[model samples]
Target: MTTGTPPPTAPKRSRARTFVPLAIAAWAVLEIWLLTLVADVAGGFTVLLLLLGGIVLGAVVTKAAGRRAFRNLTETLQQMPGRPGATAAPAAPAGGSKGNGFLMLAGLLLIIPGMISDVAGLLLLVPPVRAVLGRYTQRSLDRRMRSAAPGSFSDVFQQARMHRPDGKVVQGEVIRETDPQQGPSRNENPRPPLTP
Candidate 1:
């Protein structure tokens, strides 16, 4: 990858780049290592029970969070301000809805079959931990927004007039006669292609 800037030119198109397999391999290795250590002391069946319990609990948590989010949304809509010249409705309180997204993420992590994931998910379920995480996330986003330039999107290829395959399209100015074929339709004023 070239780091330094080159002379000004059109921007490059974004290319897809993902590390899904690499991430899965690393996560599986760590999880297996941790599970083996736990199993050596607690026995294999106990490990199985823990993993199964985590799945069940994750599902319950996910369902509860969904319901809570829906309820909060309905309440907010009900509290929407009335039409013209009236006092505005009070906005939802600060840190309101209490990070329904984080709760759902916690549930998802717990659903993943790994001890490390379960621990992380459990931590996210705590209110104090969620608050700290929320503040940190907000600050990081604010810093990113402040540092980055919001340049306009590139307009390359926008001037193009995309065409259809139908033969009915006409691409010339109208003549003020009943029929132009009766007179000279010169080569200098040749009609443009019906499709461009």
Candidate 2:
């Protein structure tokens, strides 16, 4: 944590980062050209048919691939060891989910009224792209955590312990009873004393 200078914003591997999006964009440009030509020469109904076909194609491909993608992400996160009793390891500070979410959002940007969105969505869906994104996000988080104020981690740990899943504090004090004889004996059927 430097006092004045900000941490590096650039990713460790820029080439890797650029490749997925660029490839997707290229593919999308081709699709757009072909689709537009078909629409122009074949007319609107043909274009609509192609669009539906494209959607089904994408869905089938993604369905076949998406489970493995989720598993990889989940395994990576699960392998990350947090301090004892913490539910989730403080993810690489950019938050891994945030990057994945951003990629998903990029889908919207790439889609509306242009082929760019389709390309963008494809890039985002690609596991390689997400992996790079997660790596960089983790790096960013590491730097930020190093620079955070002292006691922040401990404070967070304590807070996590206090709150249950539904937001209630599960903490309670224990009290010991001293009388052993008054306690029920194992397997006993002692009669209750008669009322005085």
Candidate 3:
């Protein structure tokens, strides 16, 4: 008596949840391998020095970028109209805040002491790359907002009431009044009939 295709079989485990751990393991392995290779080519002391220098540079960059991003966000908020605790204004354009955030992230990555992360951090510092990433992020956020519930809870209830088969029936009489001097009026007033 069943209709349509059979339901797809469910997996015993979810791949999406496991992907992050697997990726982290792979990244750790790669970092260790690269570090070992570098140590073999350069001495241990040199590698230690490089790591210390990278940490220092990352700290400075992170501090500067964080300050800049905070300033940009503050400026944007100040530029927006309306008083505090009122309806929120639309978000400011993404260029400045997004770029500064990416820069801070890059600095954090550089501080992580991995060649791959350092390279990624450097790439994020590039203006064009940062701008493109910002645009993509903004678009993704817009899409998510668009996909969310479109109206308030009351609106949802009203729509449900309109469509339900067992909804309440409002019985009433509609009276059409006409002026003596003019033609008949089409205006309808719904109310109970007056009693003598």
Candidate 4:
């Protein structure tokens, strides 16, 4: 009689870690090839015009999105709790709700010298396309969040602090004395102050 044993389970790796870089590299190669083909068909001057036009359009789009996001932030802050006329409805994130991020991403893609990217960017600029893409992205993110282990998400932004010589977490702000005239110099504070 032989005893049965379970197979060792390997740690699961995120697809994004491997897939994103590979996809980006492949896209870069294909984009360069496509640009070369376009340049060959259309004169070099035409290609230059197209590239410049795309850059300018992208810049304008990006700037508009930035301004809109900033305005949204200001409005949200003004309406946040503890302020006047604070509503029961939760405030949507500045860029997240209105597809501002997608707009910015489209601008970035258009700014990049590539036909496929430019086409995609132009598509994203359209309201209907942006809405569809935003929904898809949100669903994917929600799915990922549901699958992720509890507390893992918070770990990504966890703060770190080195313990002092006394081996305790100090609750205080650190003030740097860059200008000698401002406060005590390094020599004066050789022994760090432990004022609670």
Ranking by lDDT: 4, 1, 3, 2
- Give residue 20's error in model 1 in angstroms: 6.2
Q: Cα RMSD (Å) per model? A: 11.9, 16.9, 13.3, 12.0
* Worst window of 10 by summed lDDT in candidate 2: 91-100
Winner on lDDT between 2 and 3 is: 3
Please list all clashing residue pairs in model 2, or write none if there are none.
93-141, 110-117, 111-117
Q: Give the least accurate 10-residue stretch of model 3, judged by summed lDDT.
A: 83-92
- Relative to the unseen true structure, what is the C-alpha lDDT of residue 140 in candidate 3, on a scale of 0 to 100? 94
Where does the lowest 10-residue lDDT sum fall in candidate 1? 152-161
Q: Judged by lDDT against the true structure, how good is candidate 4?
A: 0.82
Residue by residue across 97-194, what tens digits does model 2's lDDT show?
33445454444443343444456666776677877887898899889877777679855755676665455544554444446877865666555554
Candidates' TM-scores?
0.62, 0.34, 0.59, 0.64
Using lDDT as the measure, the top candidate is: 4
| Local distance difference test, each candidate | 0.78, 0.61, 0.77, 0.82
| Model 2 Cα shift for residue 20 (angstroms) | 23
Candidate 1 achieves a global lDDT of: 0.78
Q: Candidate 4: which stretches are off by over 4 Å?
A: 1-19, 84-97, 154-196
Instruction: For model 2, state the Cα shift of residue 97 in Å.
Output: 15
